[model samples]
Target: LNSPESIAVVVAKPIYWLSVALKPIVSFLGISTEFLLKLLGVTVKEEAPVTESEINKMLTEGVAMGAYEEEEPILVENIFHLADMNAGDIMTPRTQLKWIDLNGTEDEIMEVLKNANHYRIPVGTDSLDELKGLVTVS
Candidate 1:
């Protein structure tokens, strides 16, 4: 257990468990740092690393960390290639959708907007089977 692999396994266990248990809480609070710490059974300690002395103290104490340096940037050939991934692979889909009949009168369209709080509404011919252009009510 003293090897690098063992150390990685030990260190990764808590982080993985923390991420799994905190996912719902993180989603509930919209991924805010303050919320994340609370969800992770930790406290948010704020210490400014503004001054040279403060920065040096942070580095020495391992309080603040530096970003990882990568030799090459990540490249994506087709974003749809990511479709093989499931919901957990990406952020939550928070889309607000409203459907309207394209042949409907202006008043009908306005009525839909008045009832629902949305900026854009997708126009459909008959049912949602046929989709037309989008309408902006704002």
Candidate 2:
């Protein structure tokens, strides 16, 4: 009977060889598993498993460095799973967004700008659900 280490090596060798052989085919098909894994915060480096804090730090650093903008947006056809994203991920969420009311007077708009400390505010009728336009403080 083969030793456990010998059997494991035999099993791993074929998988490694298969991956190398399939690399070109995968590239041709635009299937970048490595890229996806990287996006999911997986490190190929020979280090211990990443902690939540480490992942958060990496994500913040990536965002600050504009790493995502550097890469081409992933196409739908090339994706295996539905991408996990939120409205806040792509744009400002309603809660964080500052806006002015359509019925608000110029004085009222000025008051909002003074209080809110924002450069731009959306003008809406009744509520933000009915966006009229944008007001810039300049």
Candidate 3:
């Protein structure tokens, strides 16, 4: 193992490994520095939108750094989850809904409002299936 070729191989192994480990970081710095230099003193540059995964990552880091409460990330993540869901996932089914009937008596509408416990009650012609509009009870 003392031969010239053997010594070269031994030294090359560590150098090769070091280059492989640093390649990504070096490439990223090279590209990012170039981009920053181009954007120096520039304003209103169009940027890529922050993605849901990126938001989650940021929230996790913020929580770890004590910048955000533990519950904040859960709330933000739930909002993202909601964006992935259909209306049916959160909507109350017709059978369980309390709606206002246009032809119903005023007292009946008031009764529905009192029992509904919701700010906006659906308005329908005869039943929940025929939704005409919404009655907002403030």
What would the TM-scores of all predictions be? 0.30, 0.32, 0.43
Q: For model 2, how many clashes?
A: 0
lDDT of 2 by residue, 1-138 (tens): 659988888799899999999999989666577778778998777878976557556656776788744233333212322345655555777787778886989898777888875667788987999998887786
Pick by TM-score: 1 or 2, better one: 2
Off by over 4 Å in 2: 1-92
lDDT of 3 by residue, 52-83 (tens): 88999999999999999999999998888898
Clashes of each: 0, 0, 0
Per-residue lDDT tens digits for candidate 1, residues 4-47, read 98889778989999999999997877767667778899976788
Ranking by lDDT: 3, 2, 1
lDDT at residue 2 of model 2 (Cα atoms): 53
Taken over the whole model, the C-alpha lDDT of each candidate is 0.66, 0.72, 0.89
Candidate 2 vs candidate 3, lDDT winner:
3
- Please identify model 1 stretches exceeding 4 Å from their true place: 1-97
Residue 101's lDDT in candidate 1 = 83
Cα displacement (angstroms), candidate 2, residue 93, comes to: 4.0
